[model samples]
Target: MSIPVAGRRQLNERHHRAALGLFLVVVIAHWAEHVMQAIQIYALGWPIPEARGVLGLAFPWLVTSEWMHYGYALVMLAGLIMLRAGFTGRSRTWWNIALGLQFWHHVEHLLLLLQALSGTNLAGRPVPTSVVQLLIPRVELHLFYNAVVFAPMVVAMLLHRRPREAERAVMRCDCALRTA
Candidate 1:
C-alpha cells in the first residue's frame, strides 16, 4: 500500500530528527574528548602525550596524527552543512555562527594537513601545526576551537527545540520540544 504525501513527509521528519539526534551524540562525544584533554593538562597536570584524550590513550599516535585531526574537521564541516537546511530563524542564526567558526577551524586543520602531506612543519617545528597553533599550542588551540564551535551549536540546538511560533511553522523536521 502507498502512503499519503503527508504521511511520507512526517516519516521523513522523523528520520531527520533521529539522524540529527545521532549526530548530536557524536558531536558531544568529540567535545568531551577535548574537555577531558584540557582537564588532563590543566587540572591533572598530565603531560601532553599522556593526556591524549580517550581514543588516544589506546592509540597515542592518533593524537599527534594530522590525518585524524583533518578527518574530524572535515566531518564537522560536512555535518554542519548537511543539517543546515532544517534550521530557521534564531536557530539558523546561531547555527550560522557555529558554521562560520567551524569553517575557519576547518581551514586551520586543512593547512596543517597539507603541511604534513608535504613533509613541512610550521615555524620549523618537528610536527605540522596550524598558523594559530604556532602561538597557542596544539592542545590549547584545539580546546579553544572546540569550545567556540560547540557553544554556538548548542545554542542553536536549544533554540531549534523551542523556537518561535513562526520558526516552528516553517520547520520541516519534527525536532521541536513539546510542552507538558
Candidate 2:
C-alpha cells in the first residue's frame, strides 16, 4: 500500500518539525564525514586515497562506492522535496533555493553513478567525474555544493521558526516558536 495524498499532506502539517529534525541530523552527520575527510587530507597530510572519513575508515569500500554516494544524494533530494510544503513566505523561498541546489547535486551524483556502472568514466578518466568536477577537485567541489545547499536550508529553518505574522497565519505545522 502507498500513502495517500492526505497522508503526504499530514507529513508537512503535523509531522513537519520532527521530520525536519531527523533530516537535519542526517545532513549534519554527512557534513561531519566530509569535514573529517578534509581534516585528514589538509591537517593530517594524509594522501587523498588514504584519507577515508570515519565510517569509510572501517569500511574503506564506502569511499569508492558510487551507489552509496548516489543513494545519499537521492535521499537529500527527496527530503528537500517532501518537506517543502511545511514552509511559507520567506522560509518557502529559501527552502526552494535549497531544493533547486540539491536537484543539481543529485544530478551530479547520478552522472557519477552511471559512469561507475557503465565503466566509462567522464572524459576517459579512470574514475567517475561530475560536470563541475572537471573544473574543481572532487573533495572541494562537494564541500562547496553541500555548503551552498545547507546555507539556504539553515536560513529557511531560522525564518520558519521565527515567522512573521502573515507567515504564521498560513502555517499548518506547529514549527514556529510561541510568541510572547
Candidate 3:
C-alpha cells in the first residue's frame, strides 16, 4: 500500500483524556480489589478485627464476588467511549491507557478463576460443574464469570488495534509530526 500523508492523523484531547481517565479508574479498581482481597486473605488465615468481613458477605468472593466486580466492568465499558472520541481526532494516549487497563483486568480475572476452580472455595459451594464430579454433578461457576467479565476486553483490544494502525497511517501522511 502507498504511504499516506504524515499530517492526516489528528488526536482529540477530549477523547484522549476520557480514555486515560477511564484507564486510571480501572487501575484503581484493580488495586482496590487486590487490597481488599489481601486483607480478606490475611483475615482468614490470621485473626484480625476489621478484616473480619464487610457487608455481611462471605469471606473472599467466588461467584457472587464477580457480580460485585461487574460494577468495575461497567466503568471500564464507559471508559472505552474514549475510543469513539479518539476516532474523531481524540487523544492517542487514551488508547494506550485503555489497552493497558484492559489487559491487566483480564489477567486478574484469570487468576481468580483458577483460584475458584482449584477448590479453594470448595467448602462454601458445590462444584456445580467439574472434572472431578462427572458422576456427582459438580458445576464450575468460573466458566460464566470469566466469560462475562472478560469478553468485552477481547473485543475492545481488537478495536484498539485498529486506531494504532490509523495513527501509523496518519504519521506516514507526510504531515508535520506533532511533538507529543
Candidate 4:
C-alpha cells in the first residue's frame, strides 16, 4: 500500500519538523531541570519555602518539587501546541512563535545562572537554601544544552537566506512520492 496526496500542502514540512523537534527538546529539558531541582531539595533536606504567585498561593505540595518542574513543562506544552497550530495552518506565525519560545529557553538558562551566582531560587530564595547547592552545575549543563538545541535552527535559518537547500529538500520529497 502507499500514501495518497490530498493536495500540495507538503511544502515546507521539513522546516516545521525541525522546529518541532527543537521545541520538544526544550519541553523535555524544562521538565528535567525542574525535576532535578526538586530531587535535590528532597535528598539534601533543603527547606522549601512556601510561596505565592499569579495563581495565588504556592504550597510546596509535597516532597518531589514537582510544581516547579510542572510549570516548566507547561510552557513547553504551550510552545508545542503553538507549533502544531502553525504546522497545520502552514503559517509563518507558528514558525515565529516557535522561534520566540526557543529564545526564551536561553533566557531561562541565564536566569538560572544568575540564580546560581546570586543564590536565588524560583521562590526568590537563596541557593543551597539549606537544601541543594547544585545550581552552578545545573546552570553549566543548561548552557551547553540550550546551545545544542538552538544551533541547528540558527544555522538552518541562516542557510535559508539562499532558499536553495530548502527548495532541494522539498523537491526530493516530491520526487520520492511521485516514484513510490
Candidate 5:
C-alpha cells in the first residue's frame, strides 16, 4: 500500500501535471454524468427511475445495479487518496476538505451496496437507499454532495496551480504557475 519514496517523488516531480490532468478529466466526466442525470430528471420530466444518465441508457442494467454506484464511489475515494501526496499548503487543505466530504459519500454508497447485497433495502424500499436519502431524495442528495466535494476540489487545483511563494518553494512537482 505504500509507494516507495523515490517513486512517489518521481511521480510528483515529473508527472504530477499529467497525472492531475487525467484525474481532473475523470472527476469532471463523472460529475457530468450526475449533472446529465439531474437534467434528465428535473428538466426533461423523465421519471426518476428512467433518468439513468448516458451510460445507463446503453446499459440499462447498470442503472439498476448498486454495484455500479459503489464502484464509482470507491474509485473516487481512491483517486483522492492516491493523488493527495502531491498537494501541500492551501491546496492540501482544500483537497482534504474534498476528501473528507467524499469519505462520507463513500460510506453512504457502502451502506447502499451492503443493503443491496444483503437483500434488504433501506427503509423498506424496493431499491437500496442511503441514510441521508431517507430525508433528502437520492438524486438531489447526490447532486448536493458532488457539488460540495467538487467545489473545494476545483479550488484546490486552482490553488495548487497558483500557489504562494512559500508553497511553491516546498512543492516538488512542476505544477505551479511558471513566472515568465
Candidate 6:
C-alpha cells in the first residue's frame, strides 16, 4: 500500500533515527565501492577500464553504465530530501548544505546520463563526461563529490545527536543522546 503524507511525518517524528541509520549504511556502502575502485586503480596499478569496484568486478557493466550512476545520484538526492525534516538548528543548516551539494552532484550525473543516451559526449569526449570531469578525471571528481557531501552529512548527524536545549525542545524524534 502507498504511504500517505502523514507517513513522512511519522518518519521524521518517530522513526527518524532508524531511517537515518539505514540511510548511512547505504551511503557507506557506496563509499566503499568508490574507495575500492580507487585502490584498484592507484595501488594495484590496474588499467582504468579494468578497475571496476567490488560489485563492478562481477558486473563490469556497472562501471560503464551511466544509468546506474544516475540512479545512484537520484537515490542520494531523494534520501537527503526525505530525511531533512528530522534535522533542526545547526543540524538542519548542515543538512541543507549537504542537500545543496548533492543537488549539484545529481545534476552532474544527469548530464552524463543524457549525454550517454544521446550518444553525444560532452566537449567531444569519447565517453560521457560531467562538467567537473572536464577539469578533473571522473574517478577523482566523484571521490571529491562524495567526500564533500558526506562530510556535511556527518556534521549534521553529529549535531543532531547532541542538539542544544532549544533544538532538543523542538525535536520530535529521540535521536539525541539523553543526559543525566
**What lDDT would each prediction earn against the true structure?**
0.86, 0.95, 0.41, 0.42, 0.90, 0.95
Name the lDDT value of residue 135 in candidate 1: 88
What is the TM-score (0 to 1) of candidate 4? 0.29
Predicted candidate 3 versus true structure: per-residue lDDT over 8-39, tens digit per residue:
22323323434444565664555454445446
Clashing pairs in 6: none
Better of 3 and 5 by TM-score: 5
Name every residue pair that clashes in candidate 4: 46-131, 119-127
Estimate, for each residue in 34-152, the C-alpha lDDT of model 1 and write its tens digit: 98888888899998879988888988888888889889998898778777777899999998999999999999999999998999888888888788987898888988999899999
Residue-by-residue lDDT tens digits, candidate 6, 21-69: 9999999999999999999999999998999999999999998999999
User: Once superposed on the true structure, which residue ranges of model 5 sit more than 4 Å away at CA?
Assistant: 1-5
lDDT of 2 by residue, 1-180 (tens): 546889879999999999999999999999999999999999999999998889999999999999999999999998998899899999999999999999999999999999999999999887999999999999999899999999999999999999999999999999999999
| Superposition error at 75 for model 3 (Å) | 2.5
Q: How accurate locally is residue 123 in candidate 3, as Cα lDDT from 0 to 100?
A: 34
Each model's TM-score, in the order given? 0.88, 0.98, 0.34, 0.29, 0.94, 0.97
Q: RMSD in Å for candidate 1, one decimal?
A: 4.6
True-structure lDDT of candidate 3: 0.41
The C-alpha local distance difference test score for the whole of candidate 4 amounts to 0.42
Candidate 4 regions exceeding 4 Å error are 1-12, 50-78, 85-180
Compare candidates 1 and 6 on lDDT and give the better one.
6
After superposition of all CA atoms, the RMSD between model 6 and the true structure is 1.3
Give the 10-residue window scoring lowest on summed lDDT in candidate 1: 7-16
For model 4, state the Cα shift of residue 155 in Å: 29
What is the TM-score of candidate 3? 0.34
